[model samples]
Target: MEKEKVVLAYSGGLDTSVILKWLENTYQYEVIAVCINVGQEEDFDAIQQKALSTGAIKSYVLDVTEEFITDYIYPTLKAGAVYEDDYLLGTSFARPLMAKKLVEIAENEGAVAIAHGATGKGNDQVRFEASVKALNPYIKLIAPWRIWDLKSREDCIEYALKNDIPIPVTKKDIYSRDNNIWHISHEGGNLEDPWNQHDDSIYKLSVSPENAPDTPAYVEIQFETGIPVAVDGVKYSPIELLTVLNEVAGAHGVGIIDIVENRLVGMKSRGVYETPGGTLLFEAHKTLEKLTLDRATMSFKKSVSEKYAQLVYDGLWFTPLKEALDQFVDSTQQCVTGAVKLKLFKGSCSAVASTSPYSLYSEDFATFGEDDVYNQQDAEGFINLFALPLTIRALMNHNKDQKNKTDKKVI
Candidate 1:
């Protein structure tokens, strides 16, 4: 008889590393560690080696950075979906792609179950499990955080030490972090307290705004159908373009947000996010849409954006509603093609100018100077019709008042 195999979503982090060993010990399953890379800055080779050394029967490190950008980030970007008006949905969207790959590996290897280190308290556990169920309804999910006696990071650290497992964090300098190309999110530690101002030492991809340069830097971005294609008139691949923007905007200390957001698990979690490139792209894209998108479309899309963000954040990516919403978003983005000039200074990114061939803003019609397009006299009829309901209500009130006065006088 052979031992049942379980595919583990390995990250070389404290939780997953511990989970890798715990799964083998508890379930007596042959563990297969699958590390899915989504543009996080980590040495995959070392992670694979670590997984193999720590009782994994086999280890796989798959690079899905390009696929992540093309499939997850771009669609979310085009939809203008920002979770809770601050988070760029970096960690949210990446989870599904990673889960998809996990399922694929599990299916290929004929694994009996999939395991993840996501805790019960956070949104990630929901994200990972929801995605797994959506992709493969029958696959068993092994979540140690929900069942195991290890209640806190401290307990997990103690377990790792006893197990002789190499862990990353100490008790003193522990901040729960999720990193990808679009953004890096920091939570836990001092950020757990809402009143504590996060120290400047936490920033990884950018400088603190206080230490940013005095001079503002201007950047030009070109978009086609709502997708960023170039920066400063230089064409680049999606990954290359984002890398370039991240470097430029990061230098100016752009895209740092601190918020106490309500989680799907019915708790509030404080997080600090750094998203320099994503911030620049979003600002530029919005400016272009203002020039190209009509008033009604823009207004309706705002509502759709909120719902879309909620769906993504809640790990409902594979649902029909999200798919339909994507279609609606794609239709609106057809005309969102243009170039925008943005100014970055001290963690602020602002769009200064934009131009589009399909722009609805016509200078000839909007000019203050006298022109053939001017029709000042036409405003009277338009205003009368627009305010007809209000005018009628006022007249009705006046007639009621007059009749009441007459009745009083007659009496």
Candidate 2:
């Protein structure tokens, strides 16, 4: 009899490394580690080496950074989806692409299951499994944290030590993190305490706002159909655009957020995220939309954006609602082409100026000076009709009060 082969999502991190060994040792399954690069910093060759050394029968490292931005990141950006009004949905969107790749690999290798090292308590477990299930209903999921004896990161570290496996973090310097092209998230350690003012050491992508250069930096971004195409007057590929913006914005401490968000798994978790380029892109996209999108359309899109964010956050990216919302968002983006100038200074990005061919703003019509087309009296009829319901309601109340007084006098 032969054991089944499993495709494991590997990162060369403590959790996945331990899980790779554990799957082989405990279940007798031939583990194949699949490392998909969505622009996180790591040597792919080293990750493959670690996977093979940790008892993986084979290791794969695929670079999917550009695909991640164009497919996952751009759609979310067009929808204007931001989880809880702050998180850039970097991890949220990344998981779906990773899961899609995992499914692809599993199908290719005829693997029995796809495994991940996401903890039972966190959102990643839901995100990974949800996306996997959505893409391939038949593929089984192997979540080690939910089933294994290793209950915590500390436990995993101890297990690694016992197994003589090389792990990245020790118990003293332990903080679970996820990184990608869009953003980097840090959880656990001092971040566990909500009141613990975020330590500067936890940040990797950005300097502290206080430590940022005293001088402000200005950046101009160009967009087409709500998608960022260039930064600082330079055209770039999707990867290059974000990469440049990340470096430029990070230096000025532009995008750092610390929040306690409600996880999909019914628990709250505190995380510190740095999303420099993403922040700049979002600001420019939104400001451009304001210049071009009609007032009614923008207002309705704001309401839809919340739901879109929730769907993405809850790992429902492959669902019908999200697809439909994407369609509507795409329709609205037709006019969202423009360039926006932003000032990045000490953790803030402010839209300084914007111009678009589709701009709805008409200075000629809005100007206070005497103009041929202007008729101030036109607003009187519009206001009267708009206030008609309120006026009728007040009159009705007045009549009711008069009737009550007459009845009282007769009594």
Candidate 3:
């Protein structure tokens, strides 16, 4: 009898590499490893070779960078979703796309199931499983982290050593990390302690603020429908735009954050993230929205943005509520077409200037100097009506006090 085939979301990392071997050894399943490249700086040829050498029957490396930017990154960008006002949802956004690709490979190869190395305690498990369920409901999921007895990274390394499985990580350098075009996040090891500051060497995408140039750098970003299209007046594709911005902004030490966040699985985890290009893009997009979006729309969108961020962070990306919220977010972006100039200094990005053709700001109505459109006396009527309820309440209180005083005298 032939063994059942399983497509595994392989990243060439310690956990995934171990899981790949374990699946083959234990279940007698032919594992097909699929690696999805979403702009992470990696050698695909080496990764593919490693997968095959580690016992995968076949291996694939799919370049999903363009699709990731256009489909996943842009939609989240338009929604202005930032998890906990700090994380850009980089890992959260990438998981769904990765799972989608895994499903595709499983269908192509007639695989009976798909597998991932996502831990049972983290959000990636939810993201991967939700996406797989949404895309291919019939495909069974094998989550090794939840089922395997290898409880810690130490155990994983020991298992790998025993199996002669080559992994990029060791017990000493056991910081579990996820990297992509948007950002890079570091967790595990010393990061597990909230009191310990993140080591400066852990950051790959951004420079330390202390080591940044004393002088500031100014850059302009142009957007159409909340998507960043240009940097410093040079138009580029979504990926190119991010690439250029990352180079410019990373040099100046623009984006770095350390936070202790609430995991979706009812635990707290400390992580450090570097999101250089994304930080600049988000700041510029917000400035443009300030110019183009009306006051009421902006106010309401603020509330909507919080929920959107939560949904994305919580691994609810494929749900109906997220889709419905995207529709509302898209409607708001129609007028969010503009340019914003920003000054990057140290670790901060400040909006220096912004303008939009659809801007509701009127120079004539807002001018400090005299204008024919304004009548100073007209404010009296407007004020009276606006204060009617307050005035009536005050009068009622005064009358009650007078009646009480008179009744006291009579008594």
TM-score of each: 0.97, 0.97, 0.96
lDDT of 3: 0.90
lDDT of 2 by residue, 1-411 (tens): 987999999998887899998998888999999999999999899999999988998999999999999999999999999888988898999999999999998999889899998877888899999999999999999898888887776788899998989976444655778899999999988889999998898889999999999999999999988889888778999999999999999999989999999999898899999999999999988999888988899999998999999999999999999989999999999999989999988999999999999999999998888788878899999999999999999999999999999999999
Can you give the lDDT of residue 222 in candidate 2?
A: 94
For all candidates, the clash counts are 0, 0, 0
Error of 3 at 62 (Å): 0.9
In angstroms, how far off is 139's CA in candidate 1? 0.3
TM-score of 1: 0.97
Q: Is candidate 2 or candidate 3 better by TM-score?
A: 2
The TM-score between candidate 2 and the true structure equals: 0.97
The residue pairs that clash in candidate 1, if any, are none
lDDT of 3 by residue, 159-194 (tens): 999999996743466687889999999998888888
Task: Report the lDDT of model 3 for residue 176.
Answer: 76
Candidate with more favorable, higher lDDT: 1 or 3 = 1
| TM-score comparison, 1 vs 3, better candidate | 1
